[model samples]
Target: MSAGRDDDAQGAGAPGDAARPKVSSVLFLCGMNAIRSPIAEALARSLLPPTVYIASAGVRHGERDPFVDAVLEERGLSLGEREPQRYEDLEDGFFDLIVTMAPEAHHAALDATGTASVQVEFWPMPDPSVVTGSRDQILDAYRDLLGRIEQRIRQRFEA
Candidate 1:
């Protein structure tokens, strides 16, 4: 599914509409920190205001993907030697919003934030690693993922 407004009772306008709660902090969650979530975190940092706190984590940690670095570098962004981290590894448990990029992360976020005020959004994205082809083809998949995430972040965060 494409990234859009949270499927909540609140009416949709844009991702940053006044109808939504004020977001001071956001957490991007995925199955592994190696790819989607990290890409999101980097994009958000670049797109959102400096005052907005942004971080990313996974249901479980996985090895850092070099393709992620390549794509981010193409955009002049970087994760700065950051390592993959699990959801449980987050230093601050609370966030105004939690955006999940995978089904497992979405479920994990929902279970972890039961009854809490946090708004969790599921943005279904394909796993680029599953794409088997030439090196260029693999990079293209990563680039596609990067583009989607970047578009979503702009729509959701930019006023």
Candidate 2:
């Protein structure tokens, strides 16, 4: 565990622990996953219990967005081989909390994790694609979006 925070594997402690359920696995979702979802997953790993496995996927299985890689690089993290997967392709009964960063993702994650009784939270965040500029300029948007995702995860998951 890092000095400032506890990893999710040993998270601060889930609420209602008299008979607290197992540490919830987390699935971060987005439209294409080349961005928001992956960032959220990384941030979750840093803040939540280490045992809380995290995964991410997209609604449409679009091409891997370069911006997602760039954004994570700011924190010295890389999305190297983490290819994006369409929601329809995910295996069954895997995660406990499905976090949707895009509107479409909420429906998908719900349908995917809903049957498993997992919790779902929707976070309406901006798309780095909307950011128009040079390569460097666009990457800056990724950085900003990454910061937002990181901040939100910290607020909601950290104790």
Candidate 3:
């Protein structure tokens, strides 16, 4: 993965025509932080306003994904030195919302945020790393995943 400075520029959230709740902080979670969740964290951090704190974790820690870096690089986003971490490894300890990309992470977030004010949402996303085929085919899988997550973010935050 290539290294680049984290983009701190604020992004437009919901448009003036749409109505959505204000979310100050968000956490994206997946079975392993390697792929989905990290992609989400990077996208959200760039796609949402700077006021929205963004982070990601997994049910279990895993190595950072090169595909994730590749896919994001296509959009001019870079992962830099960010590393994969488990849910327990987050230092902030709380988020206004938790978006889980896999069943395991969803359950973990639910259990971890039990009875708390934080909202947990399950976004069942396929793991692109599981794809098998030519390099281009595998990359297609990642591109598809990235599009889906981007669409979700727009709908939920930008309407």
Candidate 4:
């Protein structure tokens, strides 16, 4: 995969709009930090406001899947700061918004983070781990997830 930067995917409006407090830094939650949440983090951090932080966590803890690294490398975001931390590891009500990549995580984040005070978005994403077939088949699902995240992040910031 080409490892450079995903900033080109943005419109001229990105830099100006990423500063919106309605969006701000986001926390992406999933069943695991392995796939969906990680992809969301990578895409959002790269395409949104450079100062706007993006982070991922799981309802349950697990190792950071290597596929997440490979996919994000293609999009040019460093995985160095992503340490597979759980939501409880951070303070509550810290993020301006929370994005749940799966329904299970939506429920979990609802319970764990008490998101009623903050914006919570449920994306209902499928687990990329369940993908079967060739490598491209797997990469395609990941790329598709990235596309969806990019769109949503743009919406939260620009619209």
**How far in Å is the alpha carbon of 155 misplaced in model 3?**
0.3
Using lDDT as the measure, what is the rank order of every candidate, best first? 1, 3, 2, 4
lDDT of 4 by residue, 32-135 (tens): 67778877777777777777777888877888777777777887776786677677776654776677877777777666544245556576666778888999
Off by over 4 Å in 1: 1-16
lDDT, model 1, position 87: 98
What TM-score fits each model? 0.90, 0.78, 0.86, 0.76
Across residues 7-116, which tens digit of lDDT does each residue of candidate 2 receive?
Answer: 23223333444433444677788898777888887777767787778888889877877777766776887777878887678785466666778878876665555345
Instruction: Give each model's whole-structure lDDT.
Output: 0.85, 0.70, 0.79, 0.68
Backbone clash numbers for all candidates listed: 0, 8, 0, 0
Lowest lDDT sum, 10 consecutive residues, model 4, at 1-10
- TM-score of candidate 3 versus the correct structure, residues matched by position: 0.86
Off by over 4 Å in 2: 1-22, 113-116
Q: Comparing candidate 1 with candidate 2, which one achieves the higher lDDT?
A: 1
Q: Could you tell me the TM-score of candidate 4?
A: 0.76
Q: What is the lDDT for 52 in model 3?
A: 89
Residue 74, model 3, lDDT: 97
The whole-model C-alpha lDDT of candidate 1 against the native structure comes to: 0.85
